[model samples]
Target: MSVTVERAVCATPSTQRSLLPVVGSGTQVPLVDGTSRVYANLDYAASAPALDAVAARVTEVLPLYASVHRGAGYLSQVSTALYEASRQTIARFVGARPEDVAIITRNTTDSLNLLARIVPTGPDGSPGRVLVLDLEHHANLLPWVQGSGHRTTILPIGPTVAATLQSLAAELSAWQYTLVAVTGASNVTGEGLPVADVVALAHTAGARVVVDGAQLVPHRGFSLTATDADYVAFSGHKTYAPFGAGALVGRRDWLDDGTPYLAGGGAVRDVRTDRTLWQPAPARHEAGSPNVIGAIALAEACAVLAALPDGALAAHELALRTRLVAGLEGIAGVEVLRIWPDSTEPVGVVTFTVEGHDPGLVAAYLAAEHGIGVRDGRFCAHPLLVRLGAPGGAIRASVGVGTPGEAVDRLLIALADYLTTGPLARYVVEDGCWVVADDTRPLIPVHGLDGLAATAAACGPTVEAASGSCRPRRAAHTAA
Candidate 1:
């Protein structure tokens, strides 16, 4: 039986604030007419904004920051202890078995790639084949293709959820697959898969299951032990940590026997000039100085999420999702993508396209005119997008703990505005990206860049001159 946690009530505004503080919730952005509005980030499916609690944890640890598992100094020992303790914390949070190992990685992609390296090959000296669904993120798909030395069979999604499960069961029974890799939720549609059912089917077929929980863990509660999944991978960025850390938690036997992921300092027990003895599981995988802060931040996020009253987070997201889906369905010329239309328990991700408008243009207009940030692309799931008949891509709006009902209303209003009046300013396609033509808003610094002018100047003279213009053009208003 699937272990069910107690579901918490939906979060009120005050409770939402207490659940997790997020960065950039009140950030301002300027529209084409030079008026600034508070930015509404609807792109949590890509990367969520950092939680203020996570930030505070980092700040608390910074002063004592030092190399992990390396130095003998006081700070180093503290850092090392915290790093190792974080492993246990994360594992416990995921409901891992006592024998399971938790290996820290850079992100979900990194974690899956590491697993790819360790997955055992078949007896004939050929690599084992992995069964994967078409609806996987590139992080889950490409690693097995490029690194696992395995032949992957991409299973087509059925028209309905039941049909999809049936297909998986049929395939598992027919093939001697080494692993069954599946996503806990569809990143594109936010539809939660029946992970417990998938696990049962895969296990009955003598295949181990790996769940790409990058999207699921943040929105719903999951237990690896309860689900009987062999492995679970997720990223901290998507879970409101925003630190450069992720985890692969699963069975220890394969990881312990497999070659170390990185052959460096901390991975070895004793090294001779000719040969070296490797450490067990985690230490073997983590060969160098670890991302101590990132790991701690991820653990902090896990702790916070775990402490949330049973279904509080899920309840809040579900309410927002209902509003969003209903609002979008009410709009003309808008089609919301879904793998299973009858699914009643989807997360807060919604992908759609407006009739007669390019997805990129619609996304640009939302940002440029409405200060609403959304993602428009194949979402790194090109095959799924193509399969869904969105070869040109679509718009994705995903919400999280930080998202408010007002944000959902704003998105609906913006979409309605777009349908009624279209974009107020002309858009131009530059280098495959749709951008506002002759935009003059001041540039926002990102990734440690000083300003847009500095970045442009670093690129070239023509771009530098273009970046210097910030005088606003006349407002172009359209009747709504």
Candidate 2:
């Protein structure tokens, strides 16, 4: 049952390649002044850096890119064919039916907006009821809250599975909601919802469910067909394909009959001065020329995830997360943000607040002083933050395919340092955060790019060597 950890360090973007070439130099950002630093990318929840393979694939296909759909030229035909094929590939990867409409939008936000627009109008022409959880990102929450007069029911995800299920059951039993929009995983704490159970409950109440997979898909592969949800949405940027593209994958009927969310040339099957007949589900929602290049890049990213050796990638991320949680434990004044410790269903992202420290200050110190890149804010999960009694927010450290063990060590070391020496004197922002890292007052790197690269390459392999097994393999890759 033990998983072998496969090294995917070679998968980093070339710009991130270290001097020795094996380990990655901190971030792609060039530190103007020489300082000792390792690019610790702990922002995978917000957006994962593009996989080298995904980027290379995009580059290879860019020159061949042309307008898609019904163009007479060979390039157009090729592009159209590739675009449609990408849809099928994505659908299959996500366990969706081949006929399921896979429409690309700007991001998760855009996909939810489109889904909101297409919801079947409720009885008496009133907007239908929408059920959402307190843990949902604003991207999932705002769309329904702002949608056409939809009566909203904010469902609470209790601290325990039994409590959560019972609460959701009671809510579903009472209301005939049209749609239940839930996050597959919490971006802040990396807690995965019991989506299959939620979907069953919603369906029993005669409501459809929309899963926000932006956080879920990046850390773990997902299958909509097996998920029991009616629709799934996620962003490519979070999935290591930062082309500003996202997908809304679901059944065809709602999209086919619903009014087109965006109206344009490709989306129209027939047009007249008086009236126009809209195209099918995907095209009806996709109005513009479309980010063909972005979609291809995202598809390529998905393919890269698909091709990764068994459970190697997920195990790697999970190992890094375990290290993070363990390292932070017993540290005085550190409070880890968590949802239901009894549940093992989570990705690597972990959030915590250091006592007597501003999250912004801590995050800034990590980035400027240590050359670490982490996110610190409400993380767009304001409601969840409020519920957790965190008025400001928490510092978040997330790992992914490219993150190395040393980077995590550096983060823990930095926090340990902060805990030892009260918050550094220079960390306080006088005017505002914008004033601290302004172009005028740049934080110098201790190690120049060359020195940093050399250190990273030398230290990288050593750090990974300590990742003593206990990793989980991909579901299919395991022999069991």
Candidate 3:
């Protein structure tokens, strides 16, 4: 059941400051007209900028880093201890149950893929179907779709979010299944789900629940125990720790019962040419050298977020979202996207579309003319995007702890200007994105990156290029 989206009214602003410092919050980016502005980074939904606390933690551990569990040196001992402590820290941050173990992985996608590998099979040697909603990120949706012989049944969205929860309850009551997966919040609309209620329904129907928390952890805090979710996966990058570290925290039985995620060093209790005995997880799955620094940095972010005064984070984000959504809705040609009319508390995400303008053009115009950063396109939730009738694309502006009211005001002003008078610079479709024609923006030169283009040509086409899908090419030149 799908309901019409609702709009929020504008709120009066108070004397509010940024909640915390984030790296690159004040960095100036050159505009196309040889002017510049401090880049208003409103792309937190994609990847949040690093928190100063996380950066400090990384610096503290950089000198102490050594081989994890592969060395007996003093540095190794400290590194190993840090790695283990980090695992525990992340687990506790999510309110992990006593029996739950946090298995560190590369990111949310990697963590979900790992959990997919361990889904239990019946005595008949067939994995049962796992149920999911239609609004999941590809990270949660695709793993189950292309799972190891496990079928997937997606519940249809209801008119209202409340009605959707009812639909989920009915679906679970009627079907016999292995597990149920849902997103803690929708990445496209930023609506938080009734996770605890969903967990109760799934559990009552003899199923477990796993939440994709990549988008939720950065804004709203949740607990595996409070929500009664069996498992949860989240990305550190989204949580203000832009490191390649994430985790799957959940029941340990399935982990130990499954095959090792990777076969290599540190996975074995005993190894011989003829036979080997594997250790229990997470060591069993986390083979090869672990990302010690990344894990530690992620832990630091969790700690900092956990320490925020009660209601401080929520109040900060609510003010930002209010200004964003109300401003977009108030605009003459803009329409903010939402799934449920009853979605009471959404995060600091507002996706909108302007009439008669492509999302690519709007995004390009924002950056080139206003020095603002926003995400455009399907946002990796292709099915959801199609359902929302934004198959072409849409523009998303997400805020974080460091985002100030002035930044929100800037975005609104720039957008209003573009719609009212049209863009100052002409935009043309170029390499899958909109680009200003004959742009004169100078590239920031980095040391030792002169051969970057040569090295790429020497190697081969990037995975995107090879796959016939490439990112928005950053060239200043217009496409052929």
Candidate 4:
């Protein structure tokens, strides 16, 4: 699906507004040339700006926030009802099966880790083998390594998406794996996986499939029943809500039969010195006061996204992706990265490398000169980055409903300027980072965190301020 959007050749915040309303969309930031510009946030894949609706939802929930479960107070009962209702909303957002249970989690990583810790042993009484592609993000790949009854067989990605599917089929036929875990989309290149087909392959081979939907849920329509995947995990931060809430929606059998993710408070039905009886499924997994407001906000985000006119969001983002990719490719020194030649654009995450510029420096220059926020590093998919021949790192510009066309145009212009005439401001290495010399931009004061902003400013160009993705300096390996 694609939508026709007017293209702009020059950079300006007034060009066009977002398709969906979001907080901090028109916020201005100080640039190095004693001028300020509207902050163009092109790093949606990392953490999307909060949707206006989600913030409102949070505000509404905060007053109702009281102790969850076992409370006689009116507010407590209301909060408990809201928490469980939010779970149902989350489940419905992904088109979960009636038997599926949505467990509240911190993020996708925490969800995956929880499942990993509880996987049941196979009939052979050993941790069975799991099949996975090399292209998955660390959140998807690393969790399997720690699964109690599973060891992963990392399959090398093929030359094409078709070949990769065939390879997965072959791998499944050759081995009796217990599970097949895969990413819904490649976080590094935005290449979506054929999840329905993958689910079919895995189920045909008698293995359950887990689709990491951290990247997919934010951009496209996802239905677990349509795909027939046994499980799917996602985070609210990537789904247009703020951080602190995520979900693991999947079959109830495994979660009910397995060990509880946590063993405190609401998790147990009866507790004594000698014995304990754990609750089932969601109650078994969730065992604390919980993030009442975060869950409500996340549910609000999901409801809002699910109610959009069919294909509206997908069309808007893919259109932006096409324009951004073409513009970047048109540059002389910029090389847009892709995993499969035949893979169509799934979301708007696009990574590229400049011929003669350090990724960190390029990101810093963009922040200092253009007020554009982009990410530059391995993106926590170190394995994928290494395979793409960008072990050092690369620049990534991801878009969402909050992004305007002018932001994309601005990024292209900034990159072209850097490639052609170099950075407008002088730069020198400070604290092992390439920072604008004598950057005079005053740090914004964050309430209650007195001197924290200034302290960060004193430390020249922290990773979040410059690259927002500078990773540990080390050899590329099979590690997060």
lDDT per prediction?
0.82, 0.74, 0.83, 0.83
- The digit string of per-residue lDDT tens for model 4 on 1-480 reads 121222433433335457799999878888888888999999999899999999988887788889998999999999999999999999999989998999999999999888888777788798877787888888888887764557789998888889999999999999888888899987888896689999999999999998899999889868999999999999999999885999999999989988898889989999999999999989898898788888888999999998899988988887788878888877766799999889875788999988767887888899899999988888888888989999988989999988888888899877777766677888765555566765667654557544545445545544334433131222222122
Q: What lDDT is reached at residue 43 by model 3?
A: 88
Give per-model CA RMSD: 7.3, 11.4, 5.4, 5.3
lDDT of 1 by residue, 230-296 (tens): 9999999998888899999999998999878888999999999999999998999998888899999
**What digit string (tens of lDDT, one per residue) describes model 2 on residues 1-480?**
121212222122222211111123344442324344457777788777787777787878887799997688989988898888777766666778766789888888998988888788676687788888888888988888784456788887798867887898898898778998988888888887678888888899999989999888877778878877889998889888888788989988988988788878778889989999898878888887888888887888887788777777677777778877877764667788887766665888899988777787777667655667888778778888888778677888987877777777777777776656543334324334411222222223554555434444544422322322111111221111
Candidate 4 global CA lDDT score: 0.83
- Local error of candidate 3 at residue 154 (angstroms): 1.6
Model 2 sits at a Cα RMSD from the real structure of: 11.4
Instruction: Compute each candidate's TM-score over C-alphas.
Output: 0.90, 0.84, 0.91, 0.91
For lDDT, candidate 1 versus 3, the one ahead is 3
Ranking by lDDT: 4, 3, 1, 2
Query: lDDT for model 1, on a 0 to 1 scale?
Result: 0.82
Candidate 1 local lDDT, residue 213 = 90
Query: Which should have the higher TM-score, number 1 or number 3?
Result: 3
lDDT of 3 at 433: 64
Which residue segments of model 3 deviate by more than 4 Å?
1-15, 448-472, 475-480
Local lDDT at 144 for model 3: 92
Error of 2 at 260 (Å): 1.2
